[model samples]
Target chain A: MVDIPEHLLIKTAEARAKALGISVEQALAEMKGEAEPTTISKEPEVIDVKPIEVKEAPAPAAAVKADIPAEVDFAPETRVTQRLLTVVKAKPIQKPTSEPVDKVNTWPHLMLPEFISLMAMTAFLIFISAILQAPLLEEANPNITPNPAKAPWYFLGLQELLSYWDPQIAGVMIPLIIGVAAFMAIPYIDRNKDNKPSKRKYAIMLWTFFLAGAGTLSLIGILFRGPGWNWTYPWIDGVWFDDLLDWVHFE
Target chain B: MKNEKIKFRDRVKDISAGLGDSLKESSLWGSIFRPGSPFRKGYSDSPRNRSYVVMNNVLYHLHPVKVKRHAVRLSYTLCLGGLSFFTFIVLTITGIWLMFYFRPTEMAYVDIQSLQTSIAFGSLVRNMHRWAAHIMVIVVFLHMSRVFYHGAYKAPREFNWVIGVILLLLTLLLSFTGYLLPWDQLAIWAVTVGGNMASYTPVIGAQVKFALFAGLEATEATLLRFYVLHVLFLPFIIVIFMAIHFWRVRKDGGISGPL
Candidate 1:
């Protein structure tokens, strides 16, 4: 007989004892082959006779009078009970082996691309550094503020929004509510399991709208707005933004 | 014993070759370079050695011994996330160099002037730091969009996406705080515009503006506060989140999607 887990053995034994109207120890002993299974000896006190082989035939209700025992006993051989099943060889809880994916060593495969990219970035950064000097204007004087002062490029979108709407709506609420909170909650909000772009048209469209809006606003804020946050073409009015004073050349 | 008037050049060559071989064959050298490391003696181009190359090295261990072939394709990821991280490292190096000269005070402007004029390679380093900060912001945003489009943020990777957003916020914070370090008119006025927006925040508007400026308006104290946050606090917090993010990526079954 196969060895069962101790807890499972105990549980099975308890279940059998309850069904057979016997002690749990007796059931456990019988299950472990330490003793013969207990047989049911108590017969029904009185009942109308019926052939055992006629299990499928229904008896006439007018002639029947039920006389089953009050204790609710059943025989081990006749009643359903836990039986020893075949043992399975011990194996890993997870699939013992995995299907191999088309893969290559990280050393040269991943590392080389990573190295090339880092080098390219370094080269690009150095080239930009040499060409366009970082604009460092005169010392910070709170007394004389630059005309149409602007936030960093990234915040130019919000700055542009501040021009159209109240600062409460554009500057504070939108950025906090939509920019941070909504952005962080995207994975949770977008319940679509399918990752293919064709299947997720709505998400793509929504994101595209955001991109277009942000890009237009920032571009307008950067080049189209001049003194007093009023609209002015960059070509007409000298570039008002001082951060990119070096990048914008007008000879 | 066989040397019958060996030439001086040949003798030198023989001794050096022996020294090089002995060094590589030594136990100390073997211990320094682990098995499968190219630096070690008897290193060979073998599949097991390739696995060991990544598994043994601390830096290389960030990646698995082998990755899905699709992962290495530059077009797939555009390398935005890695570039974001690289830009951060570049910023950190340049920022540290700048720290030796810069001080967040009334004299900050003067310090910057001298840093550009007097210090060796100061202007170049400062320029790199400034540009890298801009690059980091752009790249980080791009990384997010890439993740979104690829649907790399689905199921097991959802929380990583959230952490990424947090990282993005931290990156912006880092850039914003660093913006004021030069104490130039551009820096001050730009920050003032940003600060003014914060003042528009409801309920605790004045309080938020006050805390940000260290007073009713931007002052030397505000510069110092931004300096500390830009240099120390924000980086520290971001690093912790980054560790968790990277760890969760591996735990979430490495990169998601062949689609």
Candidate 2:
């Protein structure tokens, strides 16, 4: 007869009692009968299955420590009942499902960057304003209009368009259509899920060309269109609007 | 004599302690900031404190508490949108100063002459306003290009993009209106050519042009109207839409990140 630990015997007897719905004494009698015949033959099988069951349980994540499950199932008295307990224990222990943030709180991190950008921008504006002067030529005279009279630089794009198209199309129809399409239709028209430039090649290419066209037109209107709104280089200055009435057909 | 000196020193300490206590409990100090100053021992840093800094201040509230690191990258945003708004602020300040010496009628040209020739720092302010206005136009367009290229106009941000388009139009209109305020030949004829473009619309074309100029031509009524729009109306509209635009940026998860 091999000497079995008193606590192991007690735990085994209790596990059997619970599994069979019988008293601990009755379970202990049955375990003694089985042990007398089989001895340590069933011991390894019980130990192996108990640890595997505990390991497979997704719950009780904290029990992942190597020291815990071995101590929990050290009792060799009733292997079948202890296996049942492992399954039962797996259900109740709650797990933390959400991802951990691992992020720093936004105090000095966000505010400092914004403040620095604003300061740099203000300094640049002050430097530019110090040197240049606004243009003011003569009083409001309806008669003596300047030759190649140009709109403000922003509207120079429209002025450039006016050179090539009728006023209704250049001023109203084209701008209205472009504005509406850019704002309203773009989101639906380009339905790619990702924003990577490589992923959205066609969308990126079209918008780039559209912007380039507008910029180029503004540049031509600003620098290239000279007197009479003719195709004259910016350097030429002698003949000023000699044929303005003919070009615009104002008569 | 040593005991007498000790008593006097204790009396001085007592009075100074009372003064410090009173200052700590004062309403003036409380009015300056929240209850406990950060310099105090128990003052702690927290997420709530970070949010409170923005919530409690008027100007800082315009920004969000926790912005993603990618959104603030200078290479990604180029800070074009922020620069546009900053330029508008510069314009407002310089524009107000220029208005002090500017006359809006035919005398507007002479007033500008005197502003350049006589008024102290007048030309500097006018120049600042003019250049700032031009910079704002260019910057707003660049900002639009940045938004488009980033695909920032997609899905939930769609409406904000529309508001941005309207804002760009207002910016152009605002610049055009201010252009005529100088009342120079350049101002008059450039506006004449621009306004005539509206009259080319089909059926209601003449009516639209008349409504714009207030007569058959660009005259006193037209100048007054343009002044009102440039100074008051358009600015009001821009500010209202800009508020919506900024609030939407926060609502739409700050600036767009990668994908």
What are the per-residue Cα lDDT tens digits for candidate 1 across A156-205?
A: 98999998899899989999999999998999999999999999999989
Number of clashing residue pairs in every model?
0, 0
Best by TM-score: 1
Q: Which candidate is the best by DockQ?
A: 1
Report chain B TM per candidate: 0.90, 0.83
What's the lDDT of the predicted structure labeled candidate 1? 0.86
Candidate 2 TM-score restricted to chain A: 0.56
lDDT of 2 by residue, A74-181 (tens): 344543533323334446476769744233324445555556777886777667657545566657878776777887666778889998998788987877777556
Across B1-259, the per-residue lDDT of candidate 1 in tens digits comes to 4464244224322222334778889999888877767667666566787788788888889888888888889998888888988998999899988999988999899999998899999889988989989999999999988888889999989899999999999999999998988999989988999999999999999999999999988889999999999999999999999889888888888777788
* DockQ for all models: 0.36, 0.26
Which lDDT tens digits does candidate 2 get at residues B1-259? 9998567434422222434555645777556656223322233455565566666667766887667766656788888888888888888888878888876676777888899899998877887787778788888989988988888988788788888888988898999899788887777887888788778877898999999898989897888889889888999999999999999998986778554
CAPRI accuracy category, model 2: acceptable
**TM-score to true structure, per model:** 0.77, 0.72
Q: List the residue pairs that clash in candidate 1.
A: none
Question: Candidate 1 - CAPRI tier?
Answer: acceptable
lDDT of each: 0.86, 0.73
